[model samples]
Target: MGKKYSDIKEKLQIVVDKKTTNDLAHLTHYFQNHKNGVSQCFRSSATEYLSELHEELNIAEEPNFQYYLPIKWDIPFPPTENPTFKFIDLFAGIGGIRLAYQNNGGKCVFTSEWDTYAKKTYEANFGEVPFGDITQISEKDIPDHDVLLGGFPCQPFSIAGVSKKNSLGRKHGFLDETQGTLFFDIARIIKHKKPKAFMLENVKNLVSHDKKKTFKVIISTLEKLGYNVHFKILNGKHYVPQNRERIIIVGFKKTVFKSKETFEFPDPQESNFVFKDILEPKVDDKYTLSDKLWNYLQEHARKHKAKGNGFGFGLTDLNGISRTISARYYKDGSEVLIPQKGKNPRRLTPRECARLQGFPDKFIIPVSNNQAYKQFGNSVVTPLIQAVAKNIVKELSKINESNQSKIAVHK
Candidate 1:
């Protein structure tokens, strides 16, 4: 009998643990997608990896060599059995955007993330390991899909990114070839695959980066690819108890929507969540700040205040929203710190960070606390992404229905 995901899950990891390449990503992705049309994209590589594993382990395969059984989908976030549309996730940080699209009836055919710790967390919850280094992956290698979803690397255009780069006498934005060119990879894939629609999420500062020139180039490039682009700055505060803002860029193929797609970004929902809503009733004492660190934070805040600067640790109001949680949150937890009754304010526990990003309690955090904090801090507010994805999917359905009607009339 072919092995189920559960049957060989440990063996596969053993194989993965022994590898230095990204072949395990292919193997896991193939196991998840084999029965679907998406498998062809991964089969050759996955099969080779599986064969190597079987030989090394001295396990005899069936005469025909059944690489996998129908996947049991025993992971925390399995793919939908019957998907309404397909999408690809780029820069998929721990599957935040993936969850949003999946909830909206979209199947993720491909996903890529380069971070080792983030990939571990993603595979733990989603069952499939993601391909790494999107820049090295060819556009033609990606599967065709209805939508492309990416919360692309934003540090190149963020305020903090620019400030740090300036201090180090380094380039930021488009001038930073190391990271800035990643957007072109997204554009390259879009131009090749020509998905019906796409959604990109980035730091709010992206709109004003390089004096708006960078944003202008991005918009113009999509237009040149024959897409009708619409974008807006949306805040997570409306969905989560955090005042985080990001720019969402949506594009539809002009040939598909004819510049007449009736798509609109979702209006901000009511802010019903508060800081305490996501906080744990009982947190470990280790999360509490050290007296030395607390005193240093206080003195640092005083000096910044004296200099007329707004830089300081934010002691969150239990009943109110918090400042934006950031990837640097793990360093000092200065952006959003919880107050204690008698002790120094504490950093948010890893689980609390996940909750703040609208992740469910069932979501697994298999990484270290520091890595978990960074992953969640870099993630999207799930409910907010879902709200927007709902609208996008609705429009895609309408477009499909219209196309079907045209075909029926012609027949």
Candidate 2:
């Protein structure tokens, strides 16, 4: 009923920050349920939350049946008007995957992001601050959902992670790893929630990590949970301008989709993507590297060259794809530097980073440059996720339709 989501956000923020027992996750759940006309699904709790919101807004309690929402609104990336499915985003980094599935008629029922800066940016755009930590939040607290989406931290199974561990002569992957526990958290939630479908993404090397034992545990675990699992190594460059490759795991609950053997990953896009597509029309001078840093990078590259190692800063080719952007990009703009005709190479502006990861221009970057770089570098390519989400929805809907037909026949 509010015009601008900013006002609504402030009001919701008060409720979230209040000293009461309720928290952000509870508020978001109530808001989504209220918006989607499904408050009855959690009747007693919904009524209590509605009363609290009404008191806070200084409004009379309207009938729950009158959960009317505007056909159009003023917020950036407003909630879907009608949702075909409900999803819960775990390890939701600024809600990138949530945005993709929402575009495909999915509603985000729950979200969890731990970083303060990330939560701020997420709230700015989505008007919902994600729950602080997934590990602390019990699976029972999560709202019922049809699909579960998580871009779980890749560091535990990534090339860099394994290399660092191996250099230190420490075990990596499932053994003697803190992050190894997180993967089990996902497994526990899946076993508890038993959502019809799920999608998990990690670095491309996950398939080869620990002599493929890491990936084997993942696949076998899902299969043991009665899921028809499929995974593929997909490069984001096909969908965006960055050459980020991640291994994607898709699964359908065998108990729900009895014919789950038919599940398939999305075919990779054949479209050509280049750096210029995401580059800004005009860039700020602040992005240009200082002479000292530039000189240091050159010397570093020269030293590596002398060693016959191909390690150094990557000067992006305007007509071609770029090296993978990483979380450490902010430390130095070495991974993907852009050349200027009369100036030193520059790091991509925050906006360019967002575009490189397929975030639309409307998506807000309310955080500072440092946080923005980290968020975008760690995010998934939305268009690529969209393509994969479409296939998952198609398979789920087909099974749903078949189930409905069987029910009809019995009736």
Best of the candidates, TM-score: 1
lDDT of 2: 0.80
lDDT of 2 by residue, 348-387 (tens): 9999999989999999998889989999888899999999
- Model 1 alpha-carbon drift over 4 Å, by segment: 1-4, 14-20, 63-67
The C-alpha lDDT values of all candidates are 0.89, 0.80
Worst 10 residues of 1 by lDDT: 11-20
> Candidate 2 at residue 301, lDDT?
99
Candidate 1 TM-score, true structure as reference: 0.97
* Per-model RMSD to reference: 1.7, 3.4
Q: Which residue runs of candidate 2 sit more than 4 Å off their true CA positions?
A: 1-3, 12-22, 35-73, 165-171
